[model samples]
Target: MSQKKVDAYKAEKANREKIMKKEKRVLRLEKLIALAFCIVAVVWIGFSVYSKVNEGKEEVVVNTEMDTSALDDYLSGIATDAADAE
Candidate 1:
């Protein structure tokens, strides 16, 4: 082969290898970004579930006893008033 042609082929091969290396580097960076996103999603889901579980554990005691007592008092007062009138 001519010296000029050999040199040109060598240069083209080097250029192709450089492009491949650049592509590999970019692919690695994208993989790292995707991994980071997955980590973030897992953490978010874990926190949300933890918060929901804790909320369910914290039960509010609704006092229906007070409501019933108030109703009983009003009814008794009406019944007494009626007996007094009769």
Candidate 2:
């Protein structure tokens, strides 16, 4: 082959190799991005579910009633005792 044709072939081969490398890099980057997105989505969903499951119970309630009659009687007795002492 002529020198010009040989040089052209080498240049074309180099261009093809460069294109292939770029395509491969782009494909690898796309795969990595998809994997990262999947991981993030899974983690977000898991966290949401965990928070919902572990959240505080909203139905827990406590009811109490106190009687004050005994205390009042005791105070009245003390007042009577003090009056008697005086």
Candidate 3:
């Protein structure tokens, strides 16, 4: 082989260990990131379910006021008119 090709091959061999270590570190980081994402998704889903259950357990209150005086007056007028007709 040529002198240049021999030199390049030796240089690559010398750095093979460093390249393998870098690849292992990248793979470990990817696995850690995937685990973290799964944990976060589970926590989010649990929190939403908990919140919905608690929301259903809560009581809602409604306040309203009504006046019936006009209805009473109208009924009384009707009664008087019926008596007058009789």
* TM-score rank order: 3, 1, 2
lDDT of 1 by residue, 1-86 (tens): 99999999999897998889999999999999999999999999999999988986867888763458888999999999999999
Write one digit per residue (lDDT tens) for candidate 3, span 46-81: 999999889868677998989999999999999999
- Candidate with maximal TM-score: 3
TM-score versus the correct structure, for each prediction: 0.52, 0.51, 0.58
TM-score of 2: 0.51
Each prediction's number of clashing residue pairs: 0, 0, 0
Stretches off by above 4 angstroms in model 1 are: 1-12, 59-86
What's the CA RMSD of model 3 in angstroms? 12.0
**How well is each residue in 1-86 modelled by candidate 2, as lDDT tens digits?**
99999999999897998889999999999999999999999999999999998787577689999999999999999999999999
Residue pairs with colliding backbones in model 2 are: none
Candidate 3 matches the true fold with a TM-score of 0.58
Residue 65 in model 3: shift from native, Å? Answer: 36
lDDT of 1 at 48: 97
Q: What CA RMSD would candidate 1 show?
A: 10.7
- lDDT leaderboard ranking: 3, 2, 1
